[model samples]
Each structure stands twice: as C-alpha cells, then as structure tokens.
Target: MSDTRPTPIRPRPRNDARVVTEAAELGTVLGIWAHPDDEAFLSAGLMAAARDAGNRVVCVTATLGEHGTDDPRHWPPERLAAVRGHEVAASLAALGVSEHHILGITDGTCAEQPPDGVVRRLARIVSDVAPDTIVTFGPDGFTGHEDHQTVSRWATAARATAAPRARLLYATTTAEFAGWWEPTRHTFPVFLTDELPLRTPRSALAVELSLDDARLDRKMVALRAQATQITGLIAALGEERAREWWSSETFVAAEYAESRSSWATWQVAA
Candidate 1:
C-alpha cells in the first residue's frame, strides 16, 4: 500500500515554525476530510476566520458519515447519511463556506477503495480549487479511524500529484488536550478514546490558532448543528470543557515549496 502512495513532488522537512497570520498570504484555503462533521470539529473556526478575512474557502468531505449514528436503531445507515449530509451543509454555512464537494464514498469503508481512485478524485478537486493552502488529517487521522487515515493519505497524495506547490496542513490536537479527553472517551457511542489517534506532540505543531470569543461562539454554533454527533460530546465534556478543548486549533506543516517568510504572513486570530 505504501508503494501506491504518491511521493511528494517537492518534499521538505515537516517542522517549519513560521506562523501564518495573514489571510492574504493564505489566499484560497481548502480543507479535505473523511466525514461530514469533521470540518466542524476540526477546522470550523479556521475556515470561518479565513472566510471572514476575505479568502475563498472550500471543503471536501469524502463520506456522508452514514455510520456515525448514535441511534442506529432509528436512523440506520441510509437515513443517517442523509441527515449527516444536511448537517454538514448547515455547519459549513455557519462558517461562511458555501463551496463544498462530496465524494460519496461509502461510510466506514474509505480504506477499501483503490488508493489510485481516491487520489484521482481528490486531485481533480485540488486542481479545480487551486488553493494556496490545503488542510486535511495527518497520518494519525486524529481519531485513528481507518477511513480517516485513508482520507489523510489520499489528500496528501492528491496534493503531491495535483498541487505540489500548495502548502499542506494537518489538523491536530495537543497532547494535553488528548490527555484531558482520554478518560471521557467512552461517553460517546462512537469514536472511543482508546480507538482514536489523538494528540500530536507540541514539538510537531507548526501553527496554533486561538479562537476569540466571537470565533468560539461561531464554532459552538457549527458544532451544535451536528446534533447527532454532539449530544454525547456535550454530555461527556460538558459545554465548557468541550469549548475549552476546541478553543485552539493546531496544525503541522506537511509539505510546501514556498519560503518560510511567505508562509509566516498567514495568521490565525488570537
């Protein structure tokens, strides 16, 4: 499977500390993820900030999240997929993102598809979007789900093949947050803590964005829109703890051809 992964056209060292604080430097930003609510949980604040800063924001979800139902007995896979799709749209809307693409891959089975097919599909979107920065899950997938891992690989490969010059960023959480959330993992019907690949070391983090009150408020709205997924999250972490956990977004610079100084201009609102 490693043989099928697309090698970076211009590989460079992963840790580049230069922070991005300006939207102009970021230009158009694209976020790719495996499931519907992923953007909301992982990068909604960042997306909203970019959009508010007048940068074009686009999102691509690889699956409808059919398997994410906490009440499968009532929702089932098909019904849950439909619901999640609508939820994702509303969430993105709250973040001021109107452009999005759905790949329609089967839920919980993204890794089963041929790697080439996934790469091709994402590559086409990247080519069309032509974004300055591309964001997606890192190798750990943040949750350690096979689908998440698969999407991470596909997105990275797509960037390599179709948008080598674009700056690639991976959504991640700090080790401290992982520790705080670890004990509460079992509260969720899905995505157990033990199963999740949480926590990117602080050393690997290249950029950290702290959301302001208004941005955090918007993030909460986007998160609440995914009622099905958030019911347990809110109950487990409580509103305040959950907010604390989500207040900051972190990323590791994966690949880029631009100079560190140019990337440093992109900023996240503090």
Candidate 2:
C-alpha cells in the first residue's frame, strides 16, 4: 500500500554529534519544486521526517514565485523575488535542509522555456546528487499550474537519465483529503482547471503522513517562514484550520502509475 522506506528517527537536537546510521538505507532525498512554498505545503513533513532520520535532504526551486501576488504594484517581480529568496532559505533551514539550489528561471514562464535545456540542467543536478528518492509534482502539477507541469516533465526526464533507480514520488491528495478540502478550497483557488488533482486512496499512497504534534509544529514553522506566500491563507482559514489542513501529506509512486492504469490501482486499493 505504501512505499518500503520507513520514517526516520525523530526529536534529536540538530547539533547531535552522534554518527548517523547508513543513510543509504533510505538515501539522499531530493525535492524539485516549482515555487518556494510548494515544498512546505506539499512535502514539509516528509522531508523533515527524512532529515530527522539522518538522511541528506536537498531542495531545488525552479523559480522565486515573483508573480505570486494579488497586487503587482505593491509587490513587483524584482522585490518579490528578493523577498522569496530569503523566505525559501529560511523555510528550508527550518526543515534542516541547508543544501538548496535556485535555478533563476523566471516565475510563471516555465512552460515557455526550452524543454531540452531545462531537462539537461535538471539532469545535471540529478547526476550530481545521485538521489535515492526524488519528490515533485505529478503530471497534473498538483494544481494544474503550467509551470508545475513543466517542472514535472523536466524532473521525470532528468530522473530517467541520471537516477533511474531512484524512487519518484509525486505529491498527491487522498479521497479523504479531497473531501476535507471542500470548505477551504474556495479560500484558495489553486486549481486552474475543473479536471485537476487526481486523488489517490489512503491505502494506495506511496507515502501517507499524519504528523505528530512535534513534527506538525515544525512543519508550521517552515510554512510560516514563507510569510509572503502563506500568511494570507493562514489568516483566512484561521491558525487552527491551517494547522489541521496541512497536518497530513500523501504521495503516489510514479512507477506504479506508469505500469498500471493511472490511479486505477490506487482507487481499487481502498
């Protein structure tokens, strides 16, 4: 039902000098995200849990999310980009991920970029890291955002070239999460199309995370670090709802989706 990797040990101080166990048991985790806060919203718990278990976690942001705002006059691209750079650094730091790369791709334009060039650049990172696991959006882009879909395409190509053995997990919603999201979905019109967001069943998720208080609190900290992005949502939903909303995370394995009927097996797994 779920992936074979186990959750890493938790709660030790970041300064713990104890020698870590063989990281290869789960191996290095690489997250390639379209924007800064996407990582926090979709996979913070998973990444934090991996780090707690002593895995090396690396983050890659394709863009600075410069165009993510209601008022461009107040938040121009250059200014927003600078702010998001700091926000992403602080956000990743909160999850114990110090190694990060920003590809400097302009926000909201990934679909317009040359695919071969982008794929080559991503392939270089894959070659360098040799990650055991790669996490990113699915073909749906998790919200049907064009930039996200482009990044997913590039990551898929890169992984096939450089880390074919690595597990590729795409952020996914569960049926329960989809039902839970109804009331709050209006507060955040993230989905670009009516057919967006393929939801997996809980039993079939490659990874399903329901964070404990400590981890959930830590995840909240990471989200809060991206204030420019998530502050309004938190305020609109109220802190309690915001916390409850993100308390869970889930994913689907790309291998199974390709080998079988896409998401059909997961639907039956329930």
Among all candidates shown, the one with the greatest lDDT? 2
Judge candidate 1 at residue 187 and give its lDDT. Answer: 58
CA lDDT of every candidate: 0.76, 0.78
Candidate 2's C-alpha runs over 4 A off are 1-25, 258-270
Question: What TM-score does model 2 achieve against the real structure?
Answer: 0.84
Runs in model 1 with CA error above 4 Å?
Answer: 1-17, 21-25, 186-199, 255-270
Model 1 TM-score, all chains together: 0.83
Clashes of each: 7, 0
**Candidate 1 structure quality by residue, lDDT tens digits, 172-250:** 6666877776776665423433424345555556567888899999999999888888876688678888899888888
lDDT of 2 by residue, 1-270 (tens): 655332321322445333222223446999999999999999888788889988989999999989888888899899999999999899888889999989999988887799999889999999999999898988767886777877888999999988999988788776666776776666676765444445565544566678889988989999999999888888888888778878887776775432211211111000
What TM-score, over all chains together, does every model reach?
0.83, 0.84
Q: After superposition, how far is residue 217 of candidate 2 from its true place, in Å?
A: 0.7
Judged by whole-model lDDT over C-alpha atoms, candidate 1 comes out at: 0.76
